[model samples]
Structures are given as structure tokens and as C-alpha cells.
Target: MPEGPEIRRAGDRISRALVDKEIVKSNFYYVRIKDREEIVKNKNIKEITTRGKAMLIRFKNGWTMYSHNQLYGRWTVNLNTTKIKSTRALRVVFKTKKHTVRLWSATDIDLLPTSEEHEHSFLKKIGPDVLNESCSYKLIEERLTSKTFHKKKASTLMLDQTVFAGLGNYLRSEILFDAKIHPDDRPFDLDKTRITQWAKSIKNISHLAYKTGGFTVSKYIADRNKENGEPRKSYRHAVFMRYQYECLNCKSRIERKWYGKRKLDFCPSCQIQTGKIKPSR
Candidate 1:
């Protein structure tokens, strides 16, 4: 799944490529949108913005096209000044004077009301966007400390978009591992200092990932050659896909468990479970 950083990067790229440009043609595949003909035939892209994992492309005339890439969806910006054959799998294509932007296999494509009332109605349901500068630490702290979240596993809570937006599976695992907190541990059992530290780390790492375009285990990989360096192999084997490999920190064997059909990898020595905790209401 594409996380917050990837979504933010896509937004930045699309904005740079299409902002202020008049659309010459718009095409859709696998989706039949009402009023799409009116939307595509004549309109200019005003701005592009992201909300959680979704992208919003605003038009000059109060129409906003929303899309969520989900897992396999991708977009490509064509600038070679050569016409290529359009594929039937293409979901949406926006052509401008300078570039052609093609969206392929997106899970969602919708037209939305552009009014603040409509926008707020949708935004209010989601938690703080990790990439938004205006997101408050107080809000995150309050939400995590609430009675409703007390006994729930921190891992499960992190996956809830209402608690924190822009966190995907890999990020949740990495954040918990960095905090030295077990995924199944109860949120309230965590000390206030640790909880605050975890939140801060999440924000910092999120920023880094956003700046870097995406999070890979490579960022944590150590490079030995200062002159002409190559990333150390051990760093590449961290919590992501290295299921049974030895833990880089403690040398203990890494373990894997199924959590709601998702594979979670963690080091047994590095992350010790406190005990079985009751689920939050």
C-alpha cells in the first residue's frame, strides 16, 4: 500500500506537472463517472492536494477529482514529446500543453463537491494528517490517551485512520520497533514519556520519509566506505521483509506472526511483549 510519504510525493509531482495548465483531453478507463464529460471536456487544473492517502485535483470551476491509489495503482508523467499508444487499462489521462499525466489501475476515481462544507464533511472523519504542518501534537496525544484506546493493542490503534492518518503497515511496524514497544502491548500501559517519545519519533520519521519520497529499509542501512560507499547489507534486512533473519541489534532470531491477515516481523529480543492485554471498547 502507498503510505503518506508516497502520496505526498505524488501530489507534489502532479502539481508541478499540471498546475495552471489547461486540459486538452481527459480519458477514463474502468470507471463511468456521471458528469465526467462536463468535467473533462473543458476545465483547468487549479491545484493538487492530498488528504490522508487520497489525492484531490481541484479544477477552476469548483470540481474536484479524487483518487486513491491503493496498492497496485500508479501514475506516470510523459514528457518525451512523442505520442504513445494509450492502453485500455489506463484509468484517467490528463493532457496539457507540456505534459501528459496517466493514472493506471487506481482503486478510486470520483468527482466531489468543491465547497468547504462538502470538504469539511469528508475531512472531519479522518484523524490528523501526518504531513500537515497544522496537525497538533496535543490532538495526537489526546486521541491516544482517550478511554476508548486504553486497552487496545498499540499496533491495531495505529492502523485506525481515525487515530492517525498516513500510517501504513510498514510504517506501523517500523515505528513500534524503533520505540522498543511490542505490537500487542496496550496503549495505556505505555509510560507518558515513552508515549510522547513514540509520537515525536513518528513525526520525525514521517518527515524524513516524505522528504526522501518513500521509506525503505535503505535509510537505516549503514554505509562503510566513506569514499565510494555501498549500503551495509544488515540494514537492508531490518523489520520490513526480513522475517526469520537474525535481529541486527540483539542477534536474536526475528519472528513473524499473523495479525488480522497481515504479516508482522519483529525481533524477539528487541521487542518483548508485556502480556496478553484486553481489547479496548
Candidate 2:
């Protein structure tokens, strides 16, 4: 699934390309989009912004278009001078005087109100977005320390969008590994200092992911183009695929295990499994 950074980048692209222009044409693929014709025919795009992993395209008349590109969804922007291929599976198309933007295979494409009440109501249900500039550290700390917090494994909690939006399986593992925290450690068991450190690391990684256009881990390697270098595979396969591969840090054997339904990889010596660190008061 695309994480927060990827969505943010998409918003930036869409906003820059389509914000001021009037929508001359619009089209839809699936019937799931409510009032598709009304939205395309009447609404004028006011702005494009991202909330968590979702993208919102606000219109002048108060309606907003919301989209979440689950896994396969992708967008392509072509200048008016360029040619665009014709395809029936193309979900949503927005044509401007200067450019044409097409969204394909989007899991979500819906029209909604842009009212303050509606926006607040929607945001109220979600936790702080990791990539949002205004995301509060206090809120994150409070959420991490709240009563409902069980000592659930950090890996599992990170994937819970309710705990912190924008994190996926790959980011979860990488962030925990970067902070030198074991994926299996319970949230409450972590000291305040460790929790704060993890939160800051998440912000940094999220920014890096956005800047690199969705390529997270493999972007760090010095030689991404070596003759023997294969594009680092998806996060799951990159980390968990080679069970006996040497750890990049300590040269220890990387290990894998089934944590719930998902596979997780970690260095045994680096990520200590026991949650016995002294709490900072």
C-alpha cells in the first residue's frame, strides 16, 4: 500500500498541475463514485491536499474529491502537447487547458463536502498523520501512553492507522530498526525517551520517503545501479525473504518470524526482544 509520503507527493503534483485550471472534462471508471457526473460537470478545483494516506481535491463550490490509492492505483499527468493512450480501465480523468491528469485503478474516488464541520468530523476519527506538518508530538505521546495501550508489539501497533497514520509494513519495520527498538516490544513498555525518539524518527523517515518518491529503504544504498544490483524488492520480500542473510549492521544472521499474519525481520542482537529498559522519569 502507498504510505503517507507517496500520497503527499501525489497531492503536490496534482496541486501544481491542476489547482488554478478549470476542469474542462471529467470521466469515471467504476460505479462506486457517487454523483460522478455532477462533480465533473460543475465543481471547480480549489486546492489539493493530503490527509494521512488519502488525497483531497477541494472544489470552489465546497465539494472535495477524496481518493486512496490502495496498492495498484497510479496517476499520470501529460502535457496538452503529449499524446495519451486510450483505455477503458482508466478510472478518473481531469483535463485542463495545459495538462491532462488521469487516475487509474484507484481504490477510492468519492465526492465529499469541504465544510469545516465535515472536515473536522472526518479528521476526528483518525490519529495524527505522521507526515502532517502540524501533527502534534503531545498527541502522539498521549496516545502511546493512554489506558487502552496494551503492550502490543510495536510492529503491529505501527500498522494500526488509528495509532499513527501513514505507516505501512515496510516503514514500520524500518523505523523500529532505525530507532534500535525491537518490533516485538510492547508500546507501554517503552520509556518516554524511547517513544519520543521513535516518533521523531518516524517524522524523518516519512519526509525522506516523500522526497524520494515512494522508494524508501533501497534509496539509502550507495550503489543502486551496480551490475549485480537488483532493484531492492518490495518491503516484505526485501526484509523477510532471505532468512539467513547477514544483518547490515552487526553482520549477525537476520531472522524472520510470523507475527500475527504478517512476516517480520530483525537482527537478534540489535533489537533486543526483552522489554526491560529503564523508564526515564
Candidate 3:
């Protein structure tokens, strides 16, 4: 699944390639979207943005094209000609004078009135975008500790898009690991300072992942990996997909268990359930 960062990065790349460029043509390989080509055809793309894991391509005529790369969806930008690998999987296409932006394997594509976009089903349920500069830690804390959510497991709440949009499976593990909070614990179990610290972790990890292209491990671990000649991709994560491997901090074997069909990894020694909770700086 392409999480928020990957989706946002794709939007950025598409915006760079197609923004302000007049759409000379629009193509839809998916049956549901076949009739919606008129929405973007012969119009200019004013902007491209991401809300949660969904992408929006705003046009000069006040119409917006919304697409979500759920699971297997991906977008590609090509110069002059299309760079589609599999024609059968192609879902949507936009052709400008210099570039062609193609979306493949994505099923959630729709046309929406720009003014009514906020009422869209998926967009309406999403919480604050973690990567947005305006994402508020206080708001996140309040939501996490709210009466409706305080009883839920921390892991579950983190994965809930309605609580913090754009957070995916791996990100949930990394965020909890960085905060030194056990996934099974409730947010109410922590002190106020700890809640604020957890919120900070969410923001910091989100920004760092976006800025560093999905690297979630701290600088020390990253530098150590480089010095040891380890591959960049091998150490990009802290506790994600590291089952049975040594912990980066405590040297203990990383543990994994299924959390509602999702494999969650953590350092048992580092993230103990009962202890004095310390604020993560």
C-alpha cells in the first residue's frame, strides 16, 4: 500500500510535470471513468495536491479530479510518449503538450465539484494530514485522548485514518517504537507530557519520512549503517519487517505478532508494557 509520503511524493512529481500545462487529451481505460474525460480535457491543471492517501488534480475550470492509489495503484510521468508497462492495468491518463501522466491499477478515480470536495466520502472522514505544515500536535493529542478514542489501543488508533490521516502499517510500528510506547497500551495510560511527546513523535516521523524519502530510522542508525557498508534500503526502518532481527537500540531480538492481519514488529525489551513512561524527545 502506498502510504501518505509515497502518495504525496507522487503528487509532487505529477504536479511538477503537469501543473499549469493545458491538457490536450484525457484517457480513461477504466469503464467507470470513461465518461469523465470531459472534466479535464482541454483545460489547464491549476494544482495537484494530496489529502491523506488520495490525490486531487485541480483544473482551471474549478473542477477537480480525485484519485486514490489504494493498494496496487501507481502513477507515472513520461515525456513525449506514454511509459505504461502494462496496457491492461492502465486506469487513467492525462496528456499535456510536453508530458503524459498515467495512473495504473488505481480504482478510485472520480470527478468532483471543487467547492463540494470537502463532502466527498473519503475526504470527509480523514483527519489532519501528518505531512501538512498546518498539522497540529495539540489537535492530534486531543483526538488521541478524546472520550471516544482514549480507550482504544494506541496501535489501533494510530492506524485509524480518522485519527491521523496518511499513517499506514509500517509507519504505525515506527511511530510507536520511536515513542517507546507499547502498541497495546492506551493513550490514557500515559501522562499528559507523554501524550504531547507521542504527538510530537507523530509529527517528527511524518516530516522526516517525507523529507528523507521514507527513511524512519534516526540519524545515528543511518550513519552507523553507512559506516558498516550496509545497504541504504536495509536499515531505512527501525522495527518494521525486522522480525527476529537484533534491535537497533537494545540489541534484543525484534519480535512480531499479528495485529488484526497486520504483522507488527517491536523491541520487547525497549517497549515494555508496564514501567515508568518517559517522554520521547
Using TM-score as the measure, which candidate wins? 3
Please, what are the lDDT tens digits per residue for candidate 3 over residues 1-281?
98899889999999998898778887767777667776666688899999889999898899898899898898988997544457548887788889888888888888878998999899999888988888889888888899989989987988899888899988888988888888888987878887888899898888788877888987888787567665665478888877776888889998986887998888888888845555589
Q: In model 2, what is the error at residue 143, expressed in angstroms? A: 2.1
Cα RMSD (Å) per model?
4.9, 3.7, 2.9
What residue runs in model 3 are displaced by over 4 Å at the alpha carbon?
A: 81-84, 218-220, 226-234, 275-281
Error of 2 at 233 (Å): 2.7
lDDT of 1 at 181: 74
lDDT of 1 at 122: 48
- lDDT per residue for candidate 2 within 1-281, as digits (tens), equals 77888788888988887887877877666677745657655356889888788788788877777777888888788897897666536878888888888888886777657775246444556677878778766666677777775566787777887788788866776677666778878767777898887777677767777887755456344242222344345332224343566565787887876777877777777778654554579
lDDT tens per residue, model 1, 1-281: 88888898988998988889778877665455644656554578889998788788888888788787888788788884967775536778888888889888876777766775245544567777877887766666677788977688877876888777788877777777776778888768887887786677567667767886654344435332212232332243257555666666787877877788887777777777765435569
lDDT of each: 0.73, 0.71, 0.84
Error of 3 at 80 (Å): 1.7
CA lDDT, candidate 1, residue 9: 92
> What TM-score does model 3 achieve against the real structure?
0.92
My TM-score estimates for the predictions, one after another, are 0.84, 0.84, 0.92
What value of lDDT does candidate 1 attain over all alpha carbons? 0.73
Best by lDDT: 3
